[model samples]
Target: MKLSSFAVPILSASTAFALSKLPRPHRRAPIVHDVCGSLNSDLILNEVIDSLGRATVAGHIEVCLCLSDVVKFVESNIVAQEAVKLLGDHVKVEALISGMITGLPTGSHCSYPDHARALCTDSNPCDFECTDGYLAFPPEKPTSCKCPNHLMECDGKCGHFKECPSKAPPSRRGNEPQCAAGRTMCGIPGTSTGQPWKCVDVTTDPTTCGGCLNASPFGNAPVAGVNCEDIKGVIPGTVACGNGRCIVKDCAEGFFVAPASDACIPVPEYATVDSNQQSGEAIPGSAGSIEGPKVSRDELTAALKHGAGIAIAHFGGPVGGLKTPRDVTSGIQHGTGVLVKPVEGTSAGFKATRDVGLAHGAAKSLTAGHMGAFAGTHGIRGVDGGLIPGAGTCAKGV
Candidate 1:
């Protein structure tokens, strides 16, 4: 005998009404009493039985069995007095269960929550696969799969998009609790039960400064925050979180803090000198003066190319003109001490003499003529004025 969809509802109503007639004293039975009481109303019982019938027809044996347990629990709680009358007509009850189970169409079924069940269709069921970059939450029974962190979901797919989907503003009831002074209440995500709150100080908390980080409540947009210590290229021990922002106290040794920015930049190695002093006098503010062998242009260029620091000294007479220490004051002219080094990614350069003074006190640019005349193929000048040969590279003396 073929069972029709129309006949399933009639079968459920008749069976449920018959089951409800059992004595109320059995409703207190501990085993299935709570389950039976939850479905005590006729409308709830009929709807549950109808769903079970549809699921059974759709070959969902697990769903059918789970629903059947509810009905079996209610049936098992029949009072002893009523059992005699109910079971005496055992054939009738058995026919009712069989008819309800067997009489439904091979339609689709949705295991989603009640509000979302109606949205499910045969083509887009609750068990449909989520698009790439997204994963179904509650893997067994998912309602809406969520995108991974830092990713936004669009058109039912997740990607590296700029804007996130719009969310409703968080509603506020005046009765909500307030945080203490100097603290702001922030929401904690992924909570199962109710909304959880965290209190943070935005002014000085490095991870949550200025606001809560990636925290949203009531489906509102998340607040952005930054960690002060995470700023790139800053000296590790010189960073601080203050006034809801990152403050840098100093930069690395080879770098200096930018004039108008918090960023650190490499120190420049070149500067233009403004001195006319040709005397071989010691440069003021220099750490100290050292008398060394004359440095050839080729040698200076080689050292600068290798990022080695150099100090230059000046002599008055022609290259190799001075011979002895006693001829120093009379033969030697004004000295132009300077220091030069190569800056990374750039050609050889010079820094300010005041910042890095070498031999001469005056600041001046080193020209090819000066390099040829002063650092000729001769010996280096001693502090007292005599030229000495075989002194090592100028960089080593510095």
Candidate 2:
């Protein structure tokens, strides 16, 4: 090819003059012969030769030979030569020139870390080649083929992108339970039984089949009106009796029904007084005491109907209003009652009650005059009572 135009200006005239002064042959050897704009080895070789005209003493011939040796050096590096060959005749002159001077990657410069080789060949348009099994890179440069996700490099397969392969978890037989927690409990898959009996299934088993040390395997027991023949010692009125056994049933009346041993066990009783009841008991009391006069079912029903109030005397039982009035005859003369409580995150108890009472009074005032009357007893004055220190618009009365 026409290699004349691609050649860079000869070394500075001063440099050339200095070089020429060195006896015949040559002296300052081109220790590293890297040229730009030249791809073909022959052309590159020619450039070096032309740069060092032949006409010197025999002793300095070593200089000429040394200069020539650079050519062999460039050529011997199969990687660099192949890289240059790949660039071909289209290599950019400026890039080729700069790369030759710096020994770094230029446009189209490929890198082969294995061989540590870089080469420049054709530089007309720009072209390079390589054959040292090195990665094809740009001219006079180094580049790497790293994995996309920083995982690994492509497997030398062109058109293939680099990636990380997924690793699968080890597999185990189906019948064997993986005991990551403790021990495996599995059963034969093809067997008629559902699953092999195991301790792990008991206490944790919601099916109630049986497990847990305290549980019984009494099997399915009908609840009500069903023949309990299969059950032997099952007494009347007990959850455990359905399984042919007698068990105590705790009654809310502060007594436990003990059919197996007969006789009712009394619950702990406490003393209390009702403000409204005829009995002269004190407030805050508990159940199960035989202190008051024997109350007949009729008398209790009648007393409750008359709006007789029941207060927990002395015992500090939860405060509440009567829900149902019992006819003492049925058993006890009391019913359920809910105590006052703050929703949550509330500190003031009596204050909350007071405020709620006030609100209720206000709302009640809208419909019935009873609120005003009740408010008077609670030490609540009307809004018109005017503001006062340590009190709302209306000060509490009693």
Q: lDDT winner among the candidates?
A: 1
Model 2, 216-312: lDDT tens per residue? Answer: 2222222222122222332334333223232334343534444353234342222122332325444323463222334445554444332232332
CA lDDT, candidate 1, residue 155? 41
* Local accuracy by lDDT, each model: 0.39, 0.29
Residue 289 deviation, candidate 2, in Å? 23
Q: Which stretches of candidate 2 lie over 4 Å from their true place?
A: 1-236, 240-252, 255-376, 380-398
Q: Give the Cα-based TM-score of candidate 2 against the true structure.
A: 0.15
Tens digit of per-residue lDDT, candidate 1, span 1-398:
99899999999999999999976432211111110011111111222234347311211121221222334523553431232243455444434343443343432333422111122223342233444455554354443344545775544345797764453322243113334346666676777755365666777876576677666443342486676566666787676667777666788765656544445656433211112122334333313332334444444443333333334434332122111232222211124333432222222232221222233323333322243222212212232132223222233111
